[model samples]
Target chain A: MRTDLCDLLGIDHPIVGFSPSEHVVAAISRAGGLGVLGAVRFNDAAELDTVLTWLDRETGGRPYGVDVVMPSTVPTEGLPEDLNAMVPSGHHEFVERTLLRLGVPPLSAAQDRPGVLGWLHSVARAHVEVALNHPIRLIANALGPPPPDVISQAHDRGVLVAALAGRADHARSHVRSGVDIVVAQGYEAGGHTGEIAGMVLVPEVVDAVHVPVLAAGGIGSGRQIAAALALGARGVWMGSLWLGTTEYQSGHALREALLRATSSDTVRSRIYSGKPARLLRNRWTDAWSAQGAPAVLPMPLQNLLVSAAHDRLMASGDPTVVPMPVGQIVGRMNEVRPVAAVLSDLVTEADETLGRLHKLL
Target chain B: MRTDLCDLLGIDHPIVGFSPSEHVVAAISRAGGLGVLGAVRFNDAAELDTVLTWLDRETGGRPYGVDVVMPSTVPTEGLPEDLNAMVPSGHHEFVERTLLRLGVPPLSAAQDRPGVLGWLHSVARAHVEVALNHPIRLIANALGPPPPDVISQAHDRGVLVAALAGRADHARSHVRSGVDIVVAQGYEAGGHTGEIAGMVLVPEVVDAVHVPVLAAGGIGSGRQIAAALALGARGVWMGSLWLGTTEYQSGHALREALLRATSSDTVRSRIYSGKPARLLRNRWTDAWSAQGAPAVLPMPLQNLLVSAAHDRLMASGDPTVVPMPVGQIVGRMNEVRPVAAVLSDLVTEADETLGRLHKLL
Candidate 1:
């Protein structure tokens, strides 16, 4: 199941595991696939620097990457309190009403106030700076192409730059911006996504861009990975499949909720982070979509308005009320397994699938 | 490349070309793939019978099939005028306003009144009966499992019964209802579809069903066909790819519009039919979704109310006003070609893709 992406990314296999947990990222790197830690939740530059420093020693020097969320057009930046003030009171009221309706309790005084200033350009730039300081082999931008300076900085350090694109044109633009790889993330992906599905987008992006492309979205099994490679992707970028891994830092109840979910259990809604993201259909999403609910504010404001409520819901340990971003592949994640076991099973099944397909021709 | 489905369906290749045009159907069959002619557009039994007879001679003894749209629960059957009377006046007014806003002229007196009586259970039953009288090898129900009696009737005549499913449970239900094949149609499909995308739906359906599974939705190229087979589908069922074929009975301007469209130009909306359907985003779909527009009616009534306006829009020869049911694959339909050429190209490319993946193992 080896492809050029394996050599390009300095990984044993052409699989890239994306997770927000530093533990999962280190585990994936140790398991032969490249582990990419999502740095969007790291609001403070020092916090990200501390984590990357930990990750540098955790994987025993295996290749790993950091993913930052930076939109093409820079967004407004401010302190958490200032961003909260900008959110419309009606939207805030709706969130409050929804939390109450969902039976989520208020956070305790000991808990820190939740913030989403990471969505701001300043924070993302800081994340990139922190990531570059570590021994990272790759740097990825989740929303769009990283700024030109970031790309140049990564290249100067001999690190590969990758970006997630939902359309062929987006992939082309990323290539034009000097991205080394394009991850064609489709509509069925966990977080923010576009309308095109991976079955259509992967090949289109492959055809559009000159660089290698990794297929993402609705990819849980080895057969789907084989299918993605068959569609001309150099490898597969999988995120949602890692959520149920033992190393992922999610609540046990939320993990149980994800395990019980079917493919149809997810819906693409803007209630999560004020951008269209595929989330588990729960009270949080349903309440915001009700008839009287106010329109979700955009980006940083929406996340700032709902972050505290999200924290409370998670702290409540009520799976149905907790907001979870997941892909349609949630149906296939029926159990929690160690990262090494999951990667081993995926490689074994992918090789078997590829062998089976070879017989067809 | 052959699978067990080729032997079961008695086709040279594991591709099923789905189209309403009998001409395209015969060409696909003659080109060594199974062609399933859509009977939902045939309002008269005699008209369908005539087309089946023509297809019988046109294919020169090649295997072909018929596709009918029958809701799981039968709807009220009535004459065109009777059904039109059942439509709510508000919906009727919306359609009228939409046509006017799009500058679509009324159909001439010489043109026949458009009726969607074919959507009725009685008409669909008639289509099945007429198709049984021909040499069709398969019968596919597009909406849900054909009623138990319909399945039995097809089985009694040695005709295979197939059903389209968007979820694994639906596929299991179809298998329980005695379907010989299941077409796992995804959200990116051209016509009425469910929320699951093909990349996730195909393998899930394949695992759930005991019978052969054919992958559908966002399937335009040979590479997509290879991807489908790699995902464990026995074959591929493609509909949108035929829209630009030379044999398809569509206006040149409409074809041009499709050629000019990218994958992003289509939207899944219920404005086309009572059920959710993916259609080309144009003035027609936009007007129906604009603020103050009445809610789209369900099923037969919705089609009845919009039938006249649809006819008028088609007659206007304006690409933006014509409602075309197409998938995201519209981006790849840049030119008109013969069905044989399309099939040949798909086969050639699929074999090439499969061969490439084989080396990876």
Candidate 2:
């Protein structure tokens, strides 16, 4: 498990667990792997500050990182309120009509609206400021190459900057932008991703750039971890595998759905976010894909248009319509276990798989 | 370099080279890898018989395989002439207009019309009959599960049957339908393919089916072979990597284009075979993807519609508009080398890669 990545990150293992839950992040670090907190859901710097403080106390000064979604290209420019007006009325009507036809109820005024960054560059820069303020070991941009200033700021704070790339060209761009680590995420990964698979992209990115690369997408077990390293990645960056961990606070209905879904149950669509993201195939995705449906908008507008519909679905407690970003590895996540137990199984299985390979030689 | 797949198929190495030329196939088998002859180009049993007999004498008793394209679901049923009638005039007009605009010349009357199987089941059955008569070690179906009867027939002749699958469910279906091996191909693979990537699909298929799995798609190197093995595949099935080999009879212009093209120069479009296949992005693909382009026809009809245009493009001697099916690995294939040298490099590189992994452990 110990490799150049481990030495660089000062971790016992090269596995990096990504989650929005502070508990899962802390647990993964305590279990000898690097844990990264996804801060895209944070509404403001103050909310992020509180979460970082809690993570620092929970891990007891152990190394952890922060992940933010800052796409290299912004579809629109302006404040959230200004961008809200840019969405077409036809898209909004389509969402409403589809939800109404599906018998999904609307949300109450008292229910809280989920915070969406909406691909706004200003919102992402605020995330960078908050992440840099913490004693983080690494900062990763999920959508694309982090802006040059963000990379410089993280470096100034002695924090390594990483970016997720789906293509070899994107990985090279990240390296040129001063990223310290390149995370090659495949099409099977949750959230926004490129068409290339991890098996092909890892080796391509490794050859394209001089920096260490982390293999991501559809990775869950120790065997996959070994496969990533064999593909020339310094380590594996996993997200979907952490969604069902006991430490994470996934809703009961959503958790059960996650445990039951197969890899084929997911579809990559731009309905949830403006970019193509893999989420569990539900009525929502089918509605958007149905014939005569309005064309999906790009980036900020699409993200804005769907936010209200998502709130109504969540408030109504309709498990089938709720969007959950997950990778194809979700098929194997059939149980809820402690973070330590998951990490132990991964490490053990990877060792056994490697030993088996040695026997083959 | 050695695994159960090698022993099962009685080959010296686990690498399987896929090529249309008899010379490349014979050379690959002689160099310790399995050379699978692509027999889809043959119009009838007599044509296939002639090729198989030539391969038998060329390999000097070495084991090789035959590849046929028999999609599990036929888009339309009938003879080649009947299917040709089913193609709409609009699609025919689109093909002609696109070709004429691209400045492609008409095929010469003296040049033989290229044989196209056109996804008809009867043609595939004839291919199987021709293949089973030879001393073939394996029979691979490129599009879908070889029909159960085909698998049984191959088994009766003591030949193993393999099917290419782009999804885990597809692999499981292949095994249930009596395929002895499943070739897990990713989106980056050449020819007809699904959206799932090799990195994620290989392990999923390996876990879903009881039979040995061969990882395909963007695999073109020894390191990728090791990665497939680490992901639990018994072997690696490669196609695009063999296109640039010295033994392949690719035209001078096509060969030069292949050597110079990058990974990003390919696009998966339905223009070639009426199915989503990765081919070198050229004027033909661009024309079909352009605004106001007619909707591409399905399967056999689409395949039939494109055959004549492809013939014209090939006869024109213009490389820019020619359709060449290849994987993203084309970027790495910068040179033309003998089949033996390519096989040797793969085996040696895999051995060194395994050694490096051992050191990491």
Pick by DockQ: which candidate is best? 1
Across residues A1-361, which tens digit of lDDT does each residue of candidate 2 receive? 5789998998989999899899999999999999999987876878988999898888877799999888787558777777777877787789899889877787766776754772567777888898788899999988877878788888888999989998899889888889999999988898887777677778999999999999999899888888888889999999999988999987776787788888777898887777888988888789888899988888777877887787776666666777788888878888999999999999988887777777778
Best by TM-score: 1
Model 2 misses residue A259 by how many Å? Answer: 2.3
Candidate 1, residues B37-141, lDDT tens digits: the string is 999888889999999999999999999999999999887667877878888888777777777777888788987566767789899999999999998899999
| DockQ of prediction 2 | 0.66
For each candidate in turn, the TM-score is 0.99, 0.96
lDDT of 2 by residue, B112-163 (tens): 5854872677887888888899999999999878878888888998999889
Off by over 4 Å in 2: A73-75, B73-77, B112-115
Candidate 2 docking quality: incorrect, acceptable, medium or high: medium
> Could you tell me the lDDT of residue B119 within candidate 2?
63
Each prediction's DockQ against the real complex = 0.90, 0.66
In model 1, the Cα lDDT at residue B92 comes to 76
